[model samples]
Target: MGKFNRQLVNEIKKEKEQESAQLKLREKYEVPEDVMIVEKDNMIKFSVRIIATLIKITIGIIIFLLTVVGIVSLVFPETRNELIFQLSNTLMQLKKFLNI
Candidate 1:
């Protein structure tokens, strides 16, 4: 597996070198400054997509947890009562701290 990984890395490096050489050869045909802008745009777009996906996943997890809590509250009366008591106590503490 290590040998295969090394071979893959070497192949990728060689490909990148060849691509760079070609880009250099074609530098006169296009603006070099625009290349950087285009790369930055692609990076920003990719980053936004990743962030959106992460946000969606986080929301899904939160919803799943809420559903679990809801089911637990429905199934266990004692646990639901305990949780409500603890939540009220926490809220009261917060309210007192805020002098509200």
Candidate 2:
């Protein structure tokens, strides 16, 4: 019975060693060179996309403000006529200023 117990203990120690080796192997991780390059390209693409979105948002805001001003002028007829006259005068002045 003592010999059998010793053999059983040896078997358990061998199994433990094998499990530890497998765990160590599983812990090993590596990133490939191409993966790093792809990550950098993705980052640049995301940045450009963000800048484009910001430009679109800025244009939308400017259009919204112009629409609001136009609506306000239309709601008051006197202001609407004045705004049109002023806009024409401003455009004519700009054309003359640029000699175009």
Candidate 3:
């Protein structure tokens, strides 16, 4: 065969390989015939899972910070007194607001 013919054959082979790869990827991602697919429900479920994960992470961080603060307060009498005073002030403010 001529050089041009050989080059054409190689190009066709490369194109075929690329097409097969794309087809495999499509097949892998395609939903099965027996399965039901609802995009709206799937989106909502994914969002709810993400929000729940974030809420769990935030709660974990808050608990860790509270634990550290409690330990520090136990080791420092001044901090414990300040914490108590600040808590009382906050409660009093809330009490006034609730009375209104």
- Cα lDDT tens digits for candidate 2, 1-100: 3456888899999989866655554555343333321123588889999999999999999999999988999999999899999999999999999999
Which residue pairs collide in model 3, if any? none
The per-model lDDT (C-alpha) reads 0.82, 0.80, 0.82
**TM-score, per-candidate, Cα-based:** 0.51, 0.48, 0.45
- Candidate 2 TM-score, true structure as reference: 0.48
RMSD of each: 10.9, 17.8, 12.8
lDDT of 2 at 26: 51
Better of 2 and 3 by TM-score: 2
Predicted candidate 3 versus true structure: per-residue lDDT over 1-100, tens digit per residue = 5456888899999989866666665567795544433334588889999999999999999999999989998789999899899999999999999994
Candidate 1 lDDT, 1-100, residue by residue in tens: 3456888899999989877765775684575543532233588889999999999999999999999998998689998898899989999999999999
Candidate 3, overall lDDT?
0.82
